[model samples]
Target: MGITQVQRLSAGALKPLAALVDDLGLAAHFQGDAMLNGIDPVIRSPHRLGEASGTAQLLIGIAGAAVWHARTGKKTDIAIDIIDALHYLHPTHFVQQQGQPILVDAEHVEVNDIFLCRDNRHVMLEAGPPYMKLLKGYLNFFDCGNSKKSFAREVAKWDSEKLETAMATAGLPACRAFSREEWLAHPQGAALGQVPVIEIEKIADGKPVPFQTPALSPLQGVRVLDFTHVLAGPRSTRTLAEYGADVLHISSPAYPDTFAQHIGVDVGKRCAYLDLRNADDLVTMKRLAARADVFTNTYRPGVNARFGLLPAQLAAASERGIVCMTANAYGHSGPWAERPGFDQNGQVASGFAWKEGEPHKPRFSPVFYLGDLMTGYFAAAGMMAALLRRSTEGGSYHVTLSLTRSAMWVQELGFLETTRQASLPERDSYPARMTSIDSVYGKVSFLAPPLTFSNLALPNASRLSPYGADVPEWPA
Candidate 1:
């Protein structure tokens, strides 16, 4: 999509809020102008950079507040700051420890960057255990070692497309960067653009169960079962936790996440472990789902189906009905639906990386997983809307979102071009944007929630449990 095409997308991005309200039959209750405040020309591009993201955040907040009103007959003003929204998009960058900024290891970055191949094309390789294993395999395929230099040298020996094909065959997460024209013409990209940014489907029928209004917050008594890992899905559950939902995050020992990645997003939730492969543990998960009001996951399209934990299955297991929200890297459609992906892969496959840097050298967007963050915010909004629908209409809902679709929305929103230099906030300014909280590890500083309401405050408690620290059962 070009600048002109993206400009047209900006208007389309804002239509979701109205469509959501209409879809849920809540047009009568929702009132207010859906506008974002305090956005300027800081990060320049062809699209409405700040407005697009800020508006999505604002809409989610409003939707949450609207759900509150639906259950309690109380209305609240919703607002979001563009700067804060942008900051929330890259929370890792703004996180601090004691008084210093926490730095990601250089080796981590070196291994995860876009590399030039023999054909003069660029491919991104996200570095980690499985990725590193795949990188080693690719190197071995080319008769190379496991060092960064060796990986780069071997990558340069193969054509970009050839390497991408080999990595895909090995079920690895790697992709060759595509230009805007190339991406739009690609089948995956075309399918992605057609997918809704958020799709809420009524999967099962049930009686309307009105949520009890709480003295503290709208979601105070709600139970959210989080089966997400990494950034996007975790961030969505964290948003619910901030609003007073009892969020229990489930993971397995087989899949481990670094403290650096989990610490920022794990705040305000309980953590537990359940090995689904074990029949006993699978029974425990189903019991938890039976009592859960909402369930969220980031497992690729069919992985959950193998275990019979798909959204429809979860809804059937739960008596009170449930809201199931899921996200993935590519999308839930197209040839790449089953393909494993991440923020970097989405950036490369969706053409965002190509536009971020110069014509010759495409750099991953410096904004840091904006695609994942926005998807989280969008998921939160969609989940809230689904909740409201269940309260009124009575049915199980499945809400779907993806990193690639969010990239498309960002592309449609386009970018803002300014000669002004955009720099990070000063250390002194960090105090206002960040809050200190006690965790199992120790004191951690992280960014505050981006949205605000006139009636309720987001919980300030930031205690985080160690991975699998709690029992699998939900609170009695």
Candidate 2:
């Protein structure tokens, strides 16, 4: 099996939203008392229409020392393992690895700890007394802008040796930067099993017909390893699982469980946690990949390959398997590949931000990660096609789909056409005549004053539910 990167949810202080998930019996599988902290209430709250959903979401940011006290009563040493996990997740951490000198922000709990703590492998329980808590609180109240001035004296007093000691406590590792392809090409990558596909078309009246259904159920026995998180990636996988892919979610011990619960994305899948940093955990992931036919993740290109879940690697492990079928707001190439992207950024880039909804006054809907989600579905369809090809040809295929590409497809019909075009006026000359308002918006409205078609049935002899509805027997 290849060395794949995995993250875990923090065992630090829990946030109010995380508590809500537990109280509501959501994420019941997350048994660890280690709290999920550092959630911004504005982002986490569900009160605002289409905005805050007061839902528990996966938070990948740093935690404050006060977070532990805010939720947990007992004062305990924060684990170095937790710190290491945060370092890998934090954007600043990545910048530092590039040898960029970052003027550490003492106001930021994680940043402060990076300067104060040294080792990267120790457990939080081993850290000294409640000092971490006091420091966290101080940072919380401290003026963020004046961090350099506020921490100047301490910074001066704490020499290189003291800083080294603190660094030792963090238990972090210096990973050599590897390209996405290099990461995917690791020898151990041959663990995830093959993904197969078959093409089927409907036949009616002794002729081939397009396949369509009241409810689409194209995937039956297929299994997916849902490694992607957040609304876009999760919702995409959820849609597939809803239709019928046996989705097994692989999560980091470091990410919040409430994220899946609040968004209602885990409904059709079995979820399990894995720590990618641990050798044994990587083995477990490989084993799971060995059985999973498809794998979806949100990490930008190189990240997954470093931990070993690349398409080539997956194909090597399982002949004809579809390894990486996920969407990146930004295409996998270009200078932006290393930078993180989200739906908002994608909207801005796709020109939809300027022209959508109000003219010159673009307003956004509550569509979190719509671009990624749609891209994911399109990617899923492509994977299905590739799987079919592999089954017939016995060769592997790499499939990629992007939101930008999809947006272009959407715009093509109007903007990039070669055939004769029809001009659509802003307002139609005939309002009632042009539109069949009834049944237009998923409502049962009278059409043409309830026209009685000559051949229409006189109505059912009796209401279908006249004898009362058949009650479903669900377990109490």
lDDT of each: 0.74, 0.36
**TM-score computed on alpha carbons, candidate 1:** 0.89
Q: Determine which window of 10 residues in candidate 1 has minimal summed lDDT.
A: 1-10
RMSD of 1: 4.4
Could you tell me which 10 consecutive residues in candidate 2 have the lowest summed lDDT? Answer: 190-199
At residue 177, candidate 2 shows an lDDT of 16
Model 1 error, position 291 (Å) = 1.4
Give the per-residue lDDT of model 1 (tens digit) for 24-77.
Answer: 454566654444555444354434445666767776777777777776677766
Question: Could you report the Cα RMSD, in angstroms, for every candidate shown?
Answer: 4.4, 23.7
Per-residue lDDT tens digits for candidate 2, residues 73-189, read 223222112222222211111211122323212223232221221232111111111134434543443323324355433433444334333433442111111122232242211
